[model samples]
Target: MSNEFALNAEARSDLGKGASRRLRRNANLVPAVIYGGDKAPQSISLLAKDLAKLLENEAAFSHVLSLNVAGANETVLIKALQRHPAKGYVLHADFQRVVAGQKLQAHVPLHFMNQETAAGVKTGGGEISHTLSEVEVSCLPKDLPEFIEVDMAKVEVGQIVHLSDLKLPKGVELVALAHGSDLAVANIHMPRVQAESEDTGTAAE
Candidate 1:
């Protein structure tokens, strides 16, 4: 895997809510825990500025990260993040160790292509409605993707794009679809204003 994203951290011996609060308040560090594989859970703290800069890129969430904790480098995937409700800043993070052959689940963002030029919107006077911004996929570490592409160029009005319609990369599988749920991803439909106008016209006649 490419080491495009990396973070340097210090092994944290001070654990718990109060300690984490103090670390964030006094030292501007984000407390985090790394677990998985054959190793026990490890606690670490990262520089807030460095972590914030890394998070500026959207692909970082899906990509395998190189985390250096106290001079030891480990491959990890971001599992969860806890943020301040009002400020929307990351407070705590959870990292999962990446095992070579083991399959893991990750949420990847969906990129909609040709939304303006889609058949339904360009010629049919319809608008595109997105049902999902991201999807959870299960794949090996090597097969993980940065994002899934949703093609909208050929979609017509009144047609709903479901999870089954997505073209996934090789070795990737949708977790929801595997559990027998074919969720809707997006759709092209007539605007509500147009529908309401037509309804009023019919009532007047």
Candidate 2:
């Protein structure tokens, strides 16, 4: 899947709780900063409402972003986001600048499709299970993907779809694999109650 979205940001000179509150109230802008790639951190502000709208899509959190900060533009990935706890509005965001030449670690969402129509789910008394929602992957900025598609059509009861089994984008690699944790992205399993009843009934016989 492909998406092209842009974030418009402005340079911000003032910082601190009071200054941020004033900026939010007066200008309706949210404070943010950009860092990474040997460049010093730059303080900036993004259009609050626009930023909120962009974030509504799950891809926005994973895909590389084109940020227009004042007159300078940068390709970056979202490193972290902070929000107003009570109001649930975005207060600040942290951007990790991406360099075209270097491989960067980006979080990629996992999209599982066609599981409901799977043969296993239809006749094997199986249910779809999600093990991993997102994964950290490394790739070049130009090779970035919004998400990785995991097909559950082949998944069967008692079977697991692991990280090693995922088909990654070209030049992309998963970081979670090195952690030695075999990440089960998804699985189709028989209903717990049904399995238990079968086991108990078989044991009694």
Candidate 3:
């Protein structure tokens, strides 16, 4: 919510792969579409440099964005981005319109905190393994979180952090948890070498 992004775009009448290629090659424009809410999809084009600059910030992926299309303002969230396989430039972009008072689903990144100071690593000689890097959350656009934090300070070896164990922000809900899937987020466990050594000792006994 603290991070704000805005882009200026022009509505594009030309469509198809050929037109898109020309836009990118000649005009340095990136074709995009905005959909969702009660309105039909709108085809648009944005300056490639502008789009790239906006995407440079990681929070832009999760925070609600203000898009000015042909002088009309639309509140939206980045839904997807098509990138050139090797060069890694934006080929196409998709935006989902944000409807006020309606619940929306988006994937937010997870930030692991206190990994070095965790009880498992500091005293138990364990390593932290992350099973999920991001999680889908359901919340109103205004309540969307830039990222969720996973606290590992108190975690001990053999402790697994599950989706249900995450402390979500106010008014935010995990999509998987709502569907009854409490997926593992991260875990603190013995180092791989130590674990394997113990297993070998047990087998030899």
Residue pairs with backbone atoms closer than 3 Å in model 2 (clashes): none
State TM-scores per candidate: 0.98, 0.89, 0.94
Pitting candidate 2 against candidate 3, the one with the higher TM-score is 3
Candidate 1 wrongly placed segments (more than 4 Å): 1-3
> Tens-digit lDDT track for model 2 on 1-205?
1335788889888988898888889999988899998899988988898899989989888877889877677888899999888989898899999887898988888888888877679778799889889999878878888889998877778888899998887988888886776687888888899999999999999
* Top of the candidates by lDDT: 1
Instruction: For candidate 1, write residues 120-192 as lDDT tens digits.
Output: 9999999999999999999999999999999999999999999999999999999999999999999999999
Candidate 1 total steric clashes: 0
Using TM-score, give the best candidate's number. Answer: 1
Q: After superposition, how far is residue 127 of candidate 3 from its true place, in Å?
A: 0.8
lDDT minimum window of 10 residues, candidate 2: 1-10
The window of 10 residues in a row where model 1 has the poorest summed lDDT is: 1-10
Arrange candidates by TM-score, descending: 1, 3, 2
Q: Report how far off residue 40 is in candidate 3 (Å).
A: 1.4
| Alpha carbon lDDT at 157, candidate 3 | 97
**TM-score between model 3 and native:** 0.94
